[model samples]
Target: LVSEEELARVEARLRSINQFAPVMHCTHSSVSVDQVLNIHGFDLQRALKASPELLNTSAAPTKHDARVSSVSLDQSAPRHLRTVQKGELDLDLLQEWIGELLNNSGEDIFRMKGVLAVAHAGKRFVYHAVHMTFNGCFDEPWDDEARESKLVFIGK
Candidate 1:
């Protein structure tokens, strides 16, 4: 079990990465099945009443610096699968890229997470960056799946 202060740090870390800390409650410190299921709905009213901290935090920690209503893209359609050449990427280079991204973002970049299929690497790696910090870890191999970089970053 964690105290409220510890959970606050966790929630802050998650918010840094564009993720929300899950809220679970029960009648007692030891939870029963029914109590767990009862809050499963996660209704706004119930959540607000349960945790007043939610009110203190920003509901949408994003940007609206511009009054622009809509953004027009250069390309009419989504461009998927922009291919890369063999030997184009390696573990070290990947790390450098992630580092540069985080460092350059300052704090405008809130949350980013993705999976990369690095070239010339056997096992896949999971990448996570939150609040100017980034980490990469060894993941299972592709097995029957294809090796490809599927990454997305959400920022201001």
Candidate 2:
């Protein structure tokens, strides 16, 4: 476990580079595994429940400046795009399009995530990508909720 003073210093450094950096959560052996997992897991449902703003697909795209190093790092800010569509999508075509996007601009794309309504499927498709690596899987059944696709991209 990091000392409180050290943690504060690290957070300060991170905020200096990117003001929007999320708060750091530290865990130790004393913490239960389930609790730690809940805190650090990449579960989108948990995230959406915590921050409903992520579902606000109608909001305008925004950009934020990020600077790592004064000498070598690119000073350009990252841009965000949120897309919302109300139709079922072809899984094969969507995969192909995502592949093409990664092929064309993977380096500039920091992260991409979406919940998709796939044609002929009862469950929602959850997709996530970081740089050139991506994965998708069928999630919980849509049940009675409206089938809508929402995608968010954060990149240069």
Candidate 3:
């Protein structure tokens, strides 16, 4: 096991590399699932308290590719959470864009999560990626919810 002083030094080095990125330390036996989620910017209690209508709903489509909004937990840093919304998206184009993004700026992007409304697809495409690695699958049917694509990126 590394000493606390050594850990602090390592954390400091990482922070110097990316000041806006989250730095956390956890042992396999000590870290809870909620702690993990919080590090990734998912706050369960905050989400539970949020109104259902405020969740996953997108605004009216504009001429832009997507409406964007950003937030930063630490006032010292620039915006770290970026939300992008669109009414519909082309799956092939989206994949190409993501690939390009990872190839070009993966180091700056910490994580990305999205629920996409792909053209001609009946079910929603749900994906979450950390850095350059990605995982996605067709989730539940769109049902009554608006067929809107919402993507959130957490990055430096």
Q: Candidate 3: TM-score?
A: 0.49
What lDDT is reached at residue 17 by model 1? 51
- Evaluate all candidate structures by whole-model CA lDDT and list the values in order: 0.63, 0.74, 0.72
Per-residue lDDT of model 3, residues 1-156, tens digit only: 789899999999987754555666777657667756755665655554653433444844336323333332222233354334335788899899999998897776778887788998999999988888888989999999888776677776
> Which stretch of 10 consecutive residues in model 2 shows the poorest summed lDDT?
68-77
Tens digits of lDDT, candidate 2, 90-149: 999999999999999888888888788899999999988988999999999999998877
Model 2, which residues run further than 4 Å from truth?
Answer: 1-36, 40-63, 66-85
Candidate 1: what lDDT? Answer: 0.63
Of 1 and 3, the candidate ranking higher by TM-score: 3
Total backbone collisions for each predicted model: 1, 0, 0
The order of the candidates by TM-score, greatest first, is: 2, 3, 1
What's the TM-score of every candidate structure?
0.48, 0.53, 0.49
Best by TM-score: 2
Identify the superior model by TM-score, candidate 1 or candidate 2.
2
